[model samples]
Target: DEPGLRVKLAEGPQKFYIGVDPTGPSLHIGHLVPIYASAHLQKAGHQPIILMGGGTARIGDPSGKTELRQMISYAQIDKNIASQKPQISKLIDFDNTNALLANNADWLAPLNYIDFLRDIGRHFSVNRMLTFEAYKQRLEKGLSFIEFNYQLLQSYDFLELYRREGCILQIGGDDQWGNIVAGMELIRRVESAETYGLTFPLVTRSDGKKMGKTEKGALFLDSSLTSVYDFYQYWRNVPDADVERFFLTFTFLSVEECRALGAAEGSDINKSKERLAYEVTALLHGEKEAVKAREGAKAAFSGGGDKSGIPSEKIGKAELEAGINILDLFSRTSLCSSKSEARRLVLQGGARVNDVKIEDAEALIGMADAVDGELMLKAGKKRFFRIELTD
Candidate 1:
C-alpha cells in the first residue's frame, strides 16, 4: 500500500483527507499526528480535505475505546467543531484554494435509514467487523449497536469524499487502520476506484507514557483548557530520549535540523528542549504566546525573569489581608481542581507559595506572602500560577 500510495503521490496533486471527530471542545496534543501528517502532505502540493466528523461523532467511534463514547448533543457537537476550526487552521490553511473543510453531517445527517441499510449496510460483514481490534475489545466490555454502525458511516464517508471531492487517500492514527482500510474497500466496492489509506504510529514518550498526557490530563491546544505556559512546558519537560523523535514528528523542521538538535548532550539538551517547546507552542498558539510561555518558564525556574507569561489571576488586596487558606487558594487556581485535591497537593509538599513550601493544608496565604504585590504559586515542579494583589 505504501509503495502504491507513494507512486500516486509522486504523480501530481492528489486529494487526501483526515477526519476529526468533535468529541471534545478542544483538540489535545494526541490528535496532532494526523493533522501534522496532513500539513506535510499539503506542503507537498496535495489538496487537503479536513473532514469534521459531525455526523459520525453522533454514533461515536469505537476505535481505541473499551467503553461506549458519551454521546454529545448536536448543538454541542457544532460548537466543538467551531471551536476546533481555528486551532486546526493554525496548521492546515483552510483559506487556501487547495484546502477544504467538510462536514460529514451535510450528507450523513439526512440519509434515509432504510436506504442506507439496504445500499451501504449490505456490503459490511458482521464476522469481518467483529475481527477488527476496535470491536473485538469493545465486545468484551459490551459494544453498543450505535458504535457498531460507526465503521460503516466512516467507510461511507470515504466513498462520499471519493465521489464528491475525488479524494483518493485517507490518513489517520494507527488505531484507525481498520476503519481506513474499510473505507478504502468501500470506495473500491462502490465506486470501483483505487483509493489509499495511511496510518501514523501511536506517539508515546520514552517513559512508556502516552505523548501529550500531563498531570492535569491531556494537554489541550486551548489556552483556557490547558494554559499556553503549561503546554510549552510539556514539551520542555519531555523525556530526553523523546526530544529528537518529537522534533522530527511534530514540527515542520527539516530532518537534518531535527537530528542536529536531538544530538545535543548535557546542558545543551535543555536548549534543544526549549527550542522544541518554542517551535511547537508557536505553531499552535503563535510566536508571541510561545515567547511569553518561554519567558514564564524561565521566571518560574530562574527566579528572576518576566512573569507576565505565567498563568495568572488578580485578587483584591483586602482578600490577601484577610488571608486565604492554602488549599482554597490553590484550588481556586488551575493548580488543583478541588479542595481535596489541593489538600493532597499541599500534604504531599507539591504546593508552594512564592517559593516557600506549604506543607500544612490549613496554612494561610496573607498579605505578608505577597512580594511586590505579586504571589507566585507552584504546583509540583512544572506548573506555576501568579496572583496579583490588587487594591
Candidate 2:
C-alpha cells in the first residue's frame, strides 16, 4: 500500500546496489531502514554493493528536502564517508566476497562534464525527468541545475556498477523512487540490460513526524555523537500506537512473533517495548552496551539499582569547589535546552537533585550537595542525569 513501486523484478539471486548520500557528518537512525533492507538482501544470499555517494554528496540530493543543502568541501565529504563506513559495516557483512564497499567518486569524480551531458544526458528526457516527484517538488521553489543533474549521476552509478560488477538492483528510501527508477531505465537504455529499483517505505510515526528525532537532536549510530543509553531510550519510549508497526520495520523478529508481541494489550505492551528497545539497541551498540543501557533504564524508571549506566556528566575540581548554578549546569550539560527552560522546570518542581525537588530557580549546588561524589539529576519523570565530581 506504500507509494513508489514502478516494476517489481522477479525474485531469486540478484546483485543489489544501494547508495547513501552522506549529506551530514554522521547518519541518523532513519538511515538504518535502508541499511537493514540491504542486510536482509545479504542474508537472503544476494550480493550487496554498498556505494557511498562521495561524488553526489558534493552536489547533494534534492529529494525530500524543502530547502537547498549547503555544499560541503571534498575534505569534509571524505571525512563523513570515513566515519560512516564502520557504522554501516556493523550492520552489513562487508568482508564477504558477496559484498563490496565502493565510493561513487571513483567513477563520478573524473567524469568530463561535456562528455557526461553528451552521452548520459542525451539519453535522459528533460520533459519526462521533470515529471518525477523529486524534480516536481523542487521545481516550484526553483531547483538548481546542479541538483537537477543529481539523478543523472545517481543513475550513472547504477550503470557504472552494472558494467563493473553486473549489479542490477538499486534500493533506498521511497523518497528516492524517482532517482532509482531513472537508474533502472538508464541501465536498460544504455547497456541493453534489465535492472530493478526497490524502495522501502519512509519511517514516520503515527504522530505525523519523522522518527529518530528528540529534544536532544537526531539519534546517531556513533556512540560518541548519540550515547548508547539515549539511543536505547529513544526506542524504549515509542508511543503505544506505533509499537506494532515499528516491530516489523526495525527488528529482525519473525512475522508471527512480532504479531503476537505487538497484539498484546494494555500493560503488557511495556514488555513489548522493552524487547523492541533491547533488540534495536543490541543491533546498533552491541549486546553488552545494550544490557548496561537496559539496566540503567530500569534504574532510572524504577528508582532503584546502579545508576552508573544512566547518562553522567563529570565536573572539574574547580567546578565542584566553587559550586555551579543549577540552571547553568543543566543548560551547559545539555540536560535542558536553555537556562530559561531550566528555570521553568525548577520553578515547576520538575527539576530535582538526588531525589529532592529544587526549591528555587536560582539554587546553586556546593560541595556539600555531592553525595558520595555523585549527584543524580532528574528532569521531569523519565530523564535522569548523574553529575559526578572529580575530586
Candidate 3:
C-alpha cells in the first residue's frame, strides 16, 4: 500500500529501471525502501536495470535537498560508488540474466553539449519546468543553472536507457515523482515510447521523521560506518508505533502477521521488534551477521555483550599514557561528535566505561582499563563500543 504507484502497469510483466547517486560513501537505511521495491519488481519476472548516477552526482539533484550540495571530487565519487556496489548487490542480483548495472556517466559524460541540447533540450519547456516542485522550491533562493540542468540530464538518462535496454519504466522515492514524470515525457515526445513512472512513498516514522536516522546520523549499511550491533539496535528499539509500519515496509512478514505482532501489549511488543531487527539486518548484512548481532544485543542488555563484537577504536599508547579525557575519547570513537556532547552525555549519566556509568566528564582512560585489549564503552543503554589501547 505504501508504494503509491503514479501510473498503471501493463497487463503483463515489463522491463524497468531504478537508480541512486552515490552521494555518500555508503547507502543508508533511508535507501532501502526503493531498493526493496526494485527487488519486488525483479521477483515479478521483469528486467531490473540498476542505474548508478555517476553523471548526476556531479550536479546534485535538489528534489529533497534545501540548499546547494557541496561539490564532491571525482575521486570521492568513485570511492563512494565502489563502497555502494556490495550493498546494492545484496538486494538486486546482478548475476540474474535480466539484471544489469548501468552507469549514467557512461552516456552523459561524453555528450556533445550542442548536439544534446539540439536533440533533447528542445523537447523540454522552460515554462513547464518552472512549475515542478523540485525547481519551484529552490527558486526563491536563486537556483543555479548547473543544478537546474539536472532534471534535463536525468530525463536524458531514461531516454538513453529506453533505447539501449528497452527499459520502459522508471521508479524511485516519492521525492523523485517530478523527475520521473519528466523522464516519461521525454521518452514519449522523443521516441513516442510508452514509458511509465512509479514512485514509492519515502519511508517515514509515525512521528513523521524519515525512517533510518539516529541522533548521530543516517543509519549506514556499511559496518565500518555503522556497526552491525548498532544497526541491529536501531531497529530493535524503534518506537512502538513504528514497529508495525517498519515490519510492513522492510520485512516479508504478511500483513496479518504484522498486524498480530503490532497489536501485542506491553513488553510483548519487544519481541516483534526483535524479529524486525533480525529480518532487516539479515536482508542487509546476511543471516550470520544478524544472528551475531542479536546475540550481541542480548549480552549487552543482560549485563554486557561480547566485547569483541562491539564497535571499537584504537587509542594511541602515548595518548592513553598521558591520560586522554573521556570526552575526547568518545569524540574520537564515532560514539559522539564533540567533546561538549561527550561531556554532556557523561555528566547526564549516559556514558559508560566497562559497564560502569561515568559520574564525571573528566574520567581518563589508561592501560589498566584494557582487559585483553578491549574495554566496553556504553553510550546510554542501547549503544556499546570498545576502546583498545595501542602502540
Judging by lDDT against the true structure, name the best candidate. Answer: 1
Give model 3's TM-score versus the native structure. 0.91
**Per-residue CA lDDT of candidate 3, range 160-185, in tens?**
99999888889899989888889989
lDDT of 2: 0.85
Best by TM-score: 1
Q: What is the TM-score of each candidate against the true structure?
A: 0.98, 0.92, 0.91
* lDDT by residue for model 2 (83-201), tens: 88888887899784578889999999999999999999999999989998888989889899989889999999999999999887788999999998888888889888777777888
Residue 33's C-alpha lDDT in candidate 1? Answer: 91
Report residue 216 deviation for candidate 2 (angstroms): 1.4
Q: What is the lDDT of residue 2 in candidate 1?
A: 88
**What's the CA error at residue 300 for candidate 3, in Å?**
1.2
RMSD of each: 0.9, 2.7, 3.0
lDDT of 1 by residue, 279-301 (tens): 99999999999999999888989
lDDT of each model, Cα atoms only?
Answer: 0.93, 0.85, 0.84
Give the poorly placed runs of model 2, Cα more than 4 Å off: 1-11, 316-318, 344-349
Clash pairs of candidate 2?
none
Worst 10 residues of 1 by lDDT: 89-98
Pairs in clash, predicted candidate 1 = none
